[model samples]
Target: MAHTAGGTALTPAMKIAIAVIGVLVVAGIVVIAMLNTAGRDGAEAPPSSAPTTAVAPPTTPGPLPGATPTTGSEVPPPTAAPGTGLPPLAAAEPLVAAPLPKSGSRDGGLVAGFPTSVAEPMEDSDVVSTSIATENTAMQVSLVSSTTTALDEIRAHYRALWTSLGLREQPGDDSTMAFTGEFESLTLNVRTTGTGNMYTIFGVLRTE
Candidate 1:
């Protein structure tokens, strides 16, 4: 006599088929769960709103060579030192004395009626010579040549003048002298006396 299994009346082949169907159902559920998890992770988060770095504006190159730029402040003027006073007196007003005569080639180098006694001796190397008008109305009387002979003559002439006038010649300072005379004014005399060339310069200044 054949006996049936206690659990179910299903055949062995049918039971195997049922087990396979049950596994399939479980796998499908697992796949669905995995897909749901992946979807949750894949959804894009709110688009990032953070700001990006900004680029700086371009700088302009300096004005082209020699070309003046229209922009920028001008340089300040230089300051002068304190108490230095204004720039030296411009030759605006004639520094020279006026009332000078236009005749006789009178110039800054020569004066009219200048005394020969105070005139400096003229050097032979100097192309220009000068003199002062003497009491005898001698013009250009102070100039003497650089040569020894001419110099001796000059010394003798002045020596005679001083002697006649009772004036004394100071020993060493050739540039200065004193003469007391009846002349009415101070005079400048320059002499370039020489046999090679004769030239005279004169200047006269009146003393108050």
Candidate 2:
């Protein structure tokens, strides 16, 4: 038998057992080194893609710079009324101021609806022309005559007739007299023409 340095004698079985333990130790060391190397390299390497999620920015929309915010004080303009086609302030104006239509007379004839009894040619006066018409809801009657009667006489004649007809006298000069009442208006004028004094009677009545 061969004696070892520590005084134990070497045997085949003991050597084989020792050799198996050395192989196992080397295999364990190699596994530990590989695990350490993998951990270090993974820690040092860059990521293949961006971080899955980073700090996100604000997501709400805000007003633009210098834009004004609503304050609930806005208003719209008012609409105007539709037109009526009459003159301005036409309703408020006097009836005499209203526009009238034109009229021309025919010789010595009475128009339909003329009040011949009240406003015909004076006694002994020759009727030269007469006219009657309607305009703007009013009635107009006119008479022209040649009279030898003086202005004073004619005035007295019509004044009595007007008084009987319930017509009140309006302002007048020596040449013209005006009377108005009961929605009726009249003017009598005596003018000196080529032949003689011409007496003209013009009247307007409210047709209403």
**In candidate 2, where is summed lDDT lowest over 10 consecutive residues?**
89-98
Q: Model 1, range 1-208, lDDT digits (tens) per residue?
A: 3467775477788899999999999999999999999898778566779998998766965556787656463566798777766677433221123333232423234445433344444443333444443232222233322333353454555456554544434443333333433322122222344444332323333221
The lDDT per prediction is 0.45, 0.78
Model 1 global lDDT (CA atoms, 0 to 1): 0.45
Tens-place lDDT per residue, model 2, 1-208, is 7777888887999999999999999999999999999999999998798657777767965666777866643465688887897776323222333344454457876655566755878877888888877777677889888878887888888888977777889999989999987668989999877767789899887644
Return the top candidate by lDDT. 2
Candidate 1 error regions (>4 Å): 1-7, 44-208
lDDT for 195 in candidate 1 is 43
Q: What lDDT does candidate 1 reach at residue 120?
A: 45
**Clashes in predicted model 2:** 0
> What's the lDDT of the predicted structure labeled candidate 2?
0.78
